[model samples]
Target: MSAPLGVIVAVRGEAEAAVVAEVDAHPRLTVVRRCADLAEAVAVARAGLGAVVVLSAQPHLDADAVAAIRAAGAGIVGVGGGPGSRLEALGIAVARSALAEAVLAAVSGPAPEFVAPPERGTAAMVAVWGSGGAPGRTTVAVNLAAEAALAGHRTILVDLDTYGASVATALGLADEAPGIAAAARAAARGEDAGALLDRHALEVAPRLRVLTGLTRAARWPEVTAPGLERLWPALRAAADVVVLDLAAPADAGASPQGPGPRRDGATLAGLAEADVVIAVGGAEPHQLVRLVHVLLDHDGPTPVVAVNRIRAAVAGPRPEDAIAAALGRHAGVTEVWPLPWDLRACDAAARDGRTLAEAAPRSPLRRAIASMAEVVVAAARAARDAPATVTD
Candidate 1:
């Protein structure tokens, strides 16, 4: 005869005894472990000691924990929770009244199928990417999003920087907000991402919404590439223009959690999903070289390169010309946008927790960003008007 399926029961209270008795009596279901709590259940699941986990409704049983358990290759069946409970969102749930029948069916049942939402008028996603030396990536992303919003496009600025997420601080929003992490978790759970964003996204300005990044750098694993893959389509459906403030694209292969999600997963994911990539770089010679390398290595969409803090001290006598010649010679990039260095204006905006347009509307840097925003708006309009290609 075939071996019985391994089951881990984590139900609490008096109901636990009845559930265990029922499972033990089943011929096809074998109780491998009776976990004291969700943590133990998760650990046991991670160890691959159980094929199915029968759990109770616990306050800590969130989507992250559910994802971790599923990632460990275990099926979940909740006992005692009624319809519309948290368990329903996590996975399969059965009533305690039908313990034996429900447990058996849950363990032996075929996997449920997930239907993707029908394609609609998806938004244009723009990724603001830069190299390692802090080339004003966040600054550009924030300002560009603000400009887009000012121009009447519904814009969402997502901070996907796993290394250092400072969009919240820059925009004067609370840093501890759930932001993109919560959205990713919802996406992982197959929840309606647009509805979730409506609840979690912070509206700092008219027509502009902000989804902040990680609360802790160590929590990078929560934002996996696969999770973001599910998230991108939903994000596209949520806004007219999605601005992603991404981390530097340096490959940090497999994190400490083995060959799972890496540190740079967010950056890579954003780049892949972006309709246009705004590659930002400092105007200094060395920074310019790094930008050239970035341009050369990128094989995706044609990037709109913007050189920030352009000055005679860094780019020599004629800053704009020097930048143009260098980029043209090294990276074959002919056209370039130069954002003049206006430290006073930038400092005032940063101090006041406002975008360039709001704090220093007349700043030369603000004008440059506004012009870039116009270009982005035009690109989005063209893309939306283009014919949608069908795939097999």
Candidate 2:
């Protein structure tokens, strides 16, 4: 006297009876409903009318209908045969007796109650920006994403630096691909961001998907704060980590269009939403001054300052000590990391469109980047595992 398990049949004519008989053959499953078409089947499934769906593997069955049923959270089983009988590709398969036995054994045994997936809304943003010219924001972002992927996290690197979009070039990837702009447009139109993601994502690394910036700067209008906010939740739900390569707003003067107000661009939006910000700086006195000024304006979490191209022979005054002192005087930046100058390795890797780890894993600069990434990951994990508290 176990509860009945509903089944939906999606074949033409009297085949419904045959399908119901097949499903009822299993002792655990009691056929509760027989659907004439995929729409009716989907409606029944959505209303919690079935535990599993048994549908025919027919050519007439629309792919969208199958996708809709799957999205509604039902276990699907395909029967009979068709040109596209490859059910496994669509995350469904024929339920044989042996497979049913395995499933029953799993269900009957003491199993942990399934924890619902995390609520999807608002991304955990991390922005990588530099203080001045060539402080290496792209390098930090690319390496951070690679480290996250290496740890088996599905990660994405988003290039939001409208002024100089070098993420594609740095990864040795081509520019013919669509990216964040497409996602933004879809969000503006109230379209599903997941569908947009599937279209624009470029798998640069094994577990890393990169959303490159606009193909050209003129397309900046296509990306707005609201659009980004709308798309972020979906992107975050699909990725374990998101690294943003941001343009240094301090160098807005460098742009030929004349220094526009910093608050007018997407860089501000990116920083405002960032959970972690990697503020890159050089050993030069002016660079340290600019870094401090920038840090003071950052309203998000405390940023980590990465000192790039620290060369004692060229830049003078022990790089780390000088950079730390300058930051301490202005913003108390005690967590400064000095990266050794490795132009040959960085240049070679960029030229070949490969990450530093893949191109020059032994470089000191690359090691520093990896260490920085580890620190960020640890902090994020600690926050996620912390107990939730309700406050009045």
Candidate 3:
């Protein structure tokens, strides 16, 4: 038989005894290490020394600790029991019974299945985002997924914008299927997410699975960061390529300027988890500046920039050249794609609730989108092939 999986438990104060007793009772998990704080626990996990981590509910544990655990590529389970208390949303099973054997059985069970690993050399994320105005993010995402599918890649397009999601509307399937929100809710309740793919997804193109956004803004609370974390790994395993259409946040304030309580929080969480970010901006100077500021606050990977509504005869330099130059100086943006001002094509596509490829395949806009997809696919492949490394 295979050796028992090793697990690390993090506890503080009087909780240490409870966790130690649980670890001792588990037959399938050998407690390799115990830490008094999240940082110490993270250090042990990052060393590739443990298959799982159990973190006690402590006031000191925060989201950063959780991110570190995920970046280290280990499972984390949070424990909690008190008035007005809830377990932190780790993807692993939660143990409230304070029983060591029961908890160990849950944690040591078979790992959840995901979509097959991405193509051997493919990166895993392609994000489509836009500036303040409607820059056709959903349109770009839908057509891009279709293009990827046509190219023979098993593709999935996810709508992650909680407050103003429109993938269903763009596909003309509004309120027709229980899309991303349902999947997220299922994950939040610790249910199997693979079932979500079979039950909730609506097939928009051949071999392309569509994880649509919320049916309404009021449903934003159902989609949390932990729920998304659980869903995305399964999605990546199931599809050859994954495209995410994100809501454009105006700024990194307390919340996004949308019509809901948790809109901004959800958007920020989505950004943090995304592998690639596509920042879509308009031709205007102020709009480009806003995109730059948003990118700075995010302070992660630099995103591919796309300038929308380019009119050569109207005002300034070519939108692509101008935005590239400005972003290079301000946001260090080197990659930029441009979409020409094609109001007729955009309006017609929106009217029919179809993608630009279906409504206006010959439009100059299609070329830009196609080019963006090619670059995105290449980048994703490179990231996937990169070697894994330990982090502090």
Candidate 4:
């Protein structure tokens, strides 16, 4: 004879007694345990005491519990629920009257087996960084995000600058409570991993959303790696591309003795996770010097440089060619994208709270940014497809 089906009952209110009786009366089903709550039911399943949990559909029977039940290697027949309940996805939703048949049938079949979800590639993380003195990291990040979106990719502009985020101001988004800072704080407190994308992401354009940064500079420490560790996966899952606007690189060059100097947790995390890094720098000599030093100092991935605000006055004649030559010779950088000065377009967008693509698509600066987005996308794809290098 076939082995009796090991079942457990976890229900409340009127459905409780009926479910227990039904399982008890069924010849093929055996009451392995009657759990007081979902936690105990999950525990019982984890301990191999129950192979099936007859769970009640109540307000407290949340998706998390059902998932726990499934993850614990137990199939569940949800009772006391109707057509539009959360437990319907479990594929065993039943009313109190149908509880006996549902439980017996679910248990009669082979026990639920854990199946790994199929893997799908997400949009690569692109870090837009700048050396200090306002190299326009926000401008680069926001435009790149918008451009990526315009290129038919879902993108999110994340302002990770703990010291005064400008994405909201740049996009004219409402300064609200659910900004990155708030999400970071909540994630630090161990909230759902997807909360970062589900609750905080704000749509600025058709395919672009922006996660505004910390409103107060004092909350810089709140954007920790631990919080972002839980957030990046969710963000990647939500968007096809993520353009992280990082603050000026500053890790104090921690020596080799210890864990080294602590960099901004978010910046460190972003750099670590990024598949492409775009280093935006000013066109002037001082900014160029700083950029050179920063690239060398940063012990992270190599970056493509974008010389922003290039003008005849600052960069001399043949500005684009000149800057490219300088960085290539001095910094050994071959890929240099020189963006022309367009103060009028930038100012207009800032004032109107719109991206350049939306406010002034015809502007040279906007066009340059769009071209750069294409380059970044190509680089990301190349990096993703490249064979992993083996080392001795």
Q: Which candidate number would show the highest TM-score if scored against the true structure?
A: 1
lDDT of each: 0.82, 0.69, 0.70, 0.76
Per residue, candidate 4 scores C-alpha lDDT tens digits across 159-219 of 9986668888888877764678777665544455464567888887788888888877777
Candidate order by TM-score, decreasing, is 1, 3, 4, 2
What would the per-residue lDDT of candidate 1 be over residues 269-326, giving only the tens digit for each residue?
8888787888999998789988988898887877889999999998789999999998
Model 4 residue runs over 4 Å out of place are 1-121, 251-263, 385-392
- TM-score, candidate 2, is 0.64
Model 1 residue pairs with clashes: none
lDDT of 3 by residue, 249-279 (tens): 7454655443222555556665665566777
Residue range with the least summed lDDT across 10 consecutive positions in model 1: 111-120
Give the poorly placed runs of model 3, Cα more than 4 Å off.
Answer: 1-123, 254-262
Segments of candidate 2 deviating more than 4 angstroms = 1-124, 250-264, 314-317, 384-392
State, as a TM-score between 0 and 1, how close model 3 is to the true structure: 0.68
User: Which pairs of residues collide in model 4?
Assistant: 254-261
Lowest-sum lDDT 10-residue window in model 3:
112-121
- Which candidate comes out best when scored by lDDT? 1
